[model samples]
Target: MPQGTLPTSLPADNTPKTYSGTKLVTYILAVGATGIVPPTTLTNVAAVAAAANTLTLRAAADTFIPSGSTLTFGTAQVITTADVTATAAGAAVAIQPAATPIAANATATYTNLLEVPVAEESNPTLTDQEETINVHGRITPIRVVNGKDMTATIRTLGGIDDPVVKRLITRGMSISPNNRERIIWLYPDGFALLATVNIGAPTRQAAAGNSQRVQVSANLSGGLFWANLNDPTPIWEAVNGN
Candidate 1:
């Protein structure tokens, strides 16, 4: 009937008794003390050493048992069967299930196009004119050939005052058009088109809320030719392959 001590009946003879079940031991500092130390459980208890007034209990591992403290021994209760089943079920539900990985396929797609900054609304149009030789005696034309009358119309965001637009306009208005080399229009797929173009005067249109737009018309002098943009050699000698 002391503070921090569990209520239990004492034996009539006041002699220590052996317990077969697991033993739980609690320690108290002194008599009538209020603080109750945590209990330690010992399984398969066996007396390793005994003497006239002393007995020692050994554990499987080294454990420090404090001295000068009152000890209380009690039987440790076993866990219920329902508790074990619930713990196993909860562990099984926590594990993630296996999944099948998806295989990827090869795709042919182009993400970028021209290097030059053009308006988003601009859609460049390329046109080709074919030349045919007329035979006076024959009803149908005898020889038909694709002529070098190719032209492209490109639209840009800014008007003639823009640097890029002004450069194109200057090149078109130059006195010596034949001295300039053909410019290359590059594509994302490593292919390029070469054309000695006569850049026409830029036409400008203004609106209230939108930026001024300029339309550039290019006339291919000798026609458009496909070449590799990464080729180190001359454009004429460069060989194109797959």
Candidate 2:
């Protein structure tokens, strides 16, 4: 009776909206990398020096490897180098690899293939664990691949029959476990991440109280692939990452 109009609450610019004190998850399709398959391995004829990053082949490889192309040499040596020059067989040219060089024998090979980014989520846990030894109290050289998994809870205040909630309900029931899709987690602050995901069936629950409440839960897991040798960071701007 005292006020003629009510004040409207507006969210701050570049701020994320909170629901029930929890942030919502954003999911999307991931764009595929240009190369469908990994690059063919380039053969190495000689043993590369421990301090050297370049590779010497048995023949002129100027036509085989182009300039500004990213290639992987031996095992775990992914490098992006400048234009390669065609030189006499056994001539030493700069490899200019972006990452640490892997010690290679005569059988070492260089490849141009790359892994794709497979998944991203709102509350993601990425783990890259390594084994350590107690005898020397030192970290073991053995490494584990990075893995990610997260479960998201979705709630609807507009009753369980809400159109949007209904869509999710159908998706949870129909989506396949083998279907691999690209997912992107977007933030109001313009931060984003992209990854591949394998979705699981969703479960729904109902609460009994004065107000009608419904909740849906889903779990997903997958790995991420990277091709950028210059900067290998996963976090990126929303526009660029998307």
Candidate 3:
């Protein structure tokens, strides 16, 4: 503890040969030490770990794929949710793809006909509403305007009345009160009925005031009267064996 002497634990050496060149010196011991701590802050957006390591898609079979779209990967690895469903339209069926599913009938659509191109159906098919059947007749007279046969006593002149003529007579197409015949102003383009007047569909004779004005006639329903045949507009063109 004194300034001039070393600690008592050290042994004293008096001889020059014992400690000739080297000297031992002692220094005071300190009680405390200091350290530095680093600063920590969540200041960067890139500090968080990535949400997903990889991007992936699921695959399946027997499913519909969008046109011109590719099924990215082939294996049915993650998912296989291929499904079949109906179309928005009536009675149509379809398959929908789940994820990246493959389709056996890829081009198939919901329809009456097969999706694949094939020959026309040979079996006795039901008659479609769009289908039409044709019948034949001869036009004896082109559309000609005849005067009102108000009291049609005309049929007795020739007992051999045409079938249409017979219907007119039975229907009281001419002489009856509401069904009384009038002069039809025929359309020049013979076959069409731009406007039809009495005998076909009866109209009351124009009132004296309305006489000058042209009148368009809607068809007359045969109430008690028989309906006359439609006027004979001469369709000169006739198909053989029609």
lDDT of 2 by residue, 1-242 (tens): 58666668755332211122233234433123322322233445565555566666443343344443444443334333544433445444456642544443333333332211111113544443444455577656454433334444444443333333344455556656444445444444444555555544544444577644344444444545323323556433221111
Cα error, candidate 3, residue 13 (Å): 99
Ranking by lDDT: 2, 1, 3
Compute each candidate's TM-score over C-alphas: 0.37, 0.34, 0.14
Q: Candidates' lDDT values, in order?
A: 0.36, 0.41, 0.22
Q: What lDDT does candidate 1 reach at residue 20?
A: 14
Candidate No. with top TM-score = 1
Could you tell which candidate, 2 or 3, scores higher by TM-score?
2
Where does candidate 3 clash, by residue pair?
none
Consecutive 10-residue window with the lowest summed lDDT within model 3: 24-33
Off by over 4 Å in 2: 1-25, 28-122, 129-132, 135-141, 146-160, 175-182, 208-242
- Model 1 lDDT per residue over 171-204, tens place: 5566456323244454555665555566666677
- Quick one: best lDDT, which candidate? 2
Worst 10 residues of 1 by lDDT: 76-85
